[model samples]
Target: MDEHSTAAESINPKHQALIDRLSTRRSATTTSSDTARPVADFLSSFASSKLSIEQSLSESRSRADLDHISSLDLDQSSFDSASSSLLPRKKFSFRNKPQKKEEDPKNVAEISVEPSAIDKISSLSVRDGPGFRNEKDTTLVKDFRQCDVGQGEFTLSDLENCRVYLKGTVRALFFYRIRNCQVFTGPVLGSVLIEDVSDSLFVLASHQIRIHHAKATDFFLRVRSRPIIEDSNRVRFAPYRLTYEGIEDELKESGLGEETGNWANVDDFKWLRAVQSPNWSLIPEEEWLEIADISQCK
Candidate 1:
C-alpha cells in the first residue's frame, strides 16, 4: 500500500481517467470488432459499417474468379470459338454500290445516309465495343446489369432464326443481315441502324432509327426522334413493347425514360411524298403483342 499508493498519487486524476478510457476502447475494438467477423452478418456494427478498399478488392477478385471458374463450358466444342465472338473483332463485308471511283471497296458501313448531331458517335471505335457476332440458331441474352457501356456501340450481325435479347442501355445499336429472328432490346441512347433485315420482329427504343433494305418485318418502337427507313418495306410499327427487371432504371439513365409516341412517325427516305408511305403501316391494336416480358427469358 505504501509503494502502490505513492505511485498512483503521482498520476493526475484527469490523466488516469484518460488512460482508463483508452485501455477500454483498445480492448473493445480488438476483442469485438478487429478480429473474426461473420461474412453475412450485416447488422449495424463497426465490422459492417466500414470496409477497407483492399478488403473490398480482394473480395471482388475472389468472387470474379469463382464466377469465371463456374461458367466454364466443359462440353463446348471447338466450333463454339469459331462461331460466336465479340462483334467489333469480326469482319463484316458489306459491298457498297460503287457509285464513284474514289470510294474504297472495303464496304465501310454503319453511319446513316443523312448525318445528324449523332454523327460524332462515329469516333467510337467499333473494335472497342461489346457485341455478339457470327451467331445463329441459338438463344442470345445480354443483361446489362452492371452498366458496362458508356455511349458505346453494340452490334448484332449474321444472325438467323434466333431469339436474341439485349436488356440494357447502349449509345448505338446495329443490326445487320438478321433474318427470321425475334430481336428484343433495351434503349439505344443514341441511334439504331438496321440493314438487310427481313421476316423478323424487332422491339426497340432509341433516339433515332434508320432501316435500310429491310422487308416484311415488324417493328415495335419508342423513338425520341422521327425514325427513317431508306429502303425498307412492309414493316409494321407499334409502341415499344419490351420489359425486364431493372429496365426502368436503365431507360431513365439512357434518356429514354418516357414514351414519345414517335414509333409511327416513320419517315421513308425513298418515299418523300404527300401520301403515306406504303412501305410501313401501323399494326392494329388487336395484333399488337403484350408488353413483352423478357425478364423470364434469360
Candidate 2:
C-alpha cells in the first residue's frame, strides 16, 4: 500500500480511455483474420483444378503427334509418295473393243440345151389355182410285172415316183394319146414334159433329172381312166457305148443310138427321154435288156 497505492493514486482518466481504444482494435483484427483464412483456402483449391485440366489437354496433343510420325515407312519412296501425297491422281481404262464386218457371195455356172429342148412346159397339175384336178386314172403295177420295153431286170419297187431323163422329140402323135386320156397337166408340166409313146402304156418323158446326179425316173399311170398309181425306177443309161442286146437293141430300133448315149449331147440341145413302165421287158420296144451305164443313169 505504501508505493503501489501511491502509483495507482497517480493514474489519469485519459490513460484509461487510451487502453479501451487499443482493446477494440485488437477484437476487430481477430474477426478479419477469421474471414480471410476461408476465402484464401477456396481460391487455392480452384487454381489446382484449373492446372489439372490444362495438363491433361497438353498430354493428349503430344500423344497424337507421336502417333502420326511413327506410322510412316520413309524407306520406300513409292510408298511414302502414296502416303504423303497432298493431291492424288485418279486413273481410268476401257475394255471390249468393237468388231469388224463380213463379206458377200458370188455366182456359179450355166446349163446347155437345144432350142426344142428349152421349150416351156406345156401343161401340168397345179396346187395353187383352179385347174386343181386329181389323177384321172390310177393303176397299180405289182412286182415282176413285165413292161413293154425289153429293158433289163427291173422291179416295180423301182418305179414308184422315180425321176427320169429322155433325149427325144415329143411328137404330135404322143399328144393325141395323152390328151385322149384323163391325165392332169399344169404344175407338173412346169417342171417336166411327156413325149412320144414307147408302148400303149409307157412313153418318152423328161423330169428333173441329171445323169451326173443319177436321179431316178418317174411316171404316172391311170386306173379307171384316172391317175391312181405313180411309177418310179432306178436305171443306168450308157447310150454312148450301148450294145444291142435285148432292151438296148429295142432302144436302138426306136431311133435312139449308142452314140447318142442315154443323154443326147446334140449341141446346146441335150435331148433326153423319160420312160415309165411296170415291166419294160414285156413291151416289144422295151424288152428286158441291160442298158449300160446304169450307175450313171439319171
**Best lDDT among the predictions, by candidate number:** 1
Model 2 residue 62 lDDT score = 53
What shift in Å separates residue 184 of candidate 1 from its native position after superposition?
A: 0.7
TM-scores, all candidates, are 0.56, 0.20
| Model 1 residue 154 lDDT score | 82
* Angstrom error at residue 108, model 1: 23
Per-residue error (Å), model 1, residue 213? 0.7
Which residue pairs does candidate 1 place in steric collision?
none
Q: List candidate 1 stretches off by more than 4 Å.
A: 1-128, 147-151
Residue 68, candidate 2: Cα error in Å is 9.5
Per-model CA lDDT versus the true structure: 0.71, 0.27
User: lDDT tens digits, residues 1-298, model 2?
Assistant: 5533333233323334433543443344345565444334533543464355334433444545434433421234542353223222233545665655443223222233322421322232222321112222343221111323222211111122222222212211112112122221111111122332122222222222111111132222111111111121232221122221243433344343223222322111222345433222112235323332222222
How far does residue 19 in candidate 2 sit from its true spot (Å)? Answer: 82
* lDDT per residue (tens digit) for residues 244-292 in model 1: 9888888887788988889978899899799999999999999998988
TM-score of 1: 0.56
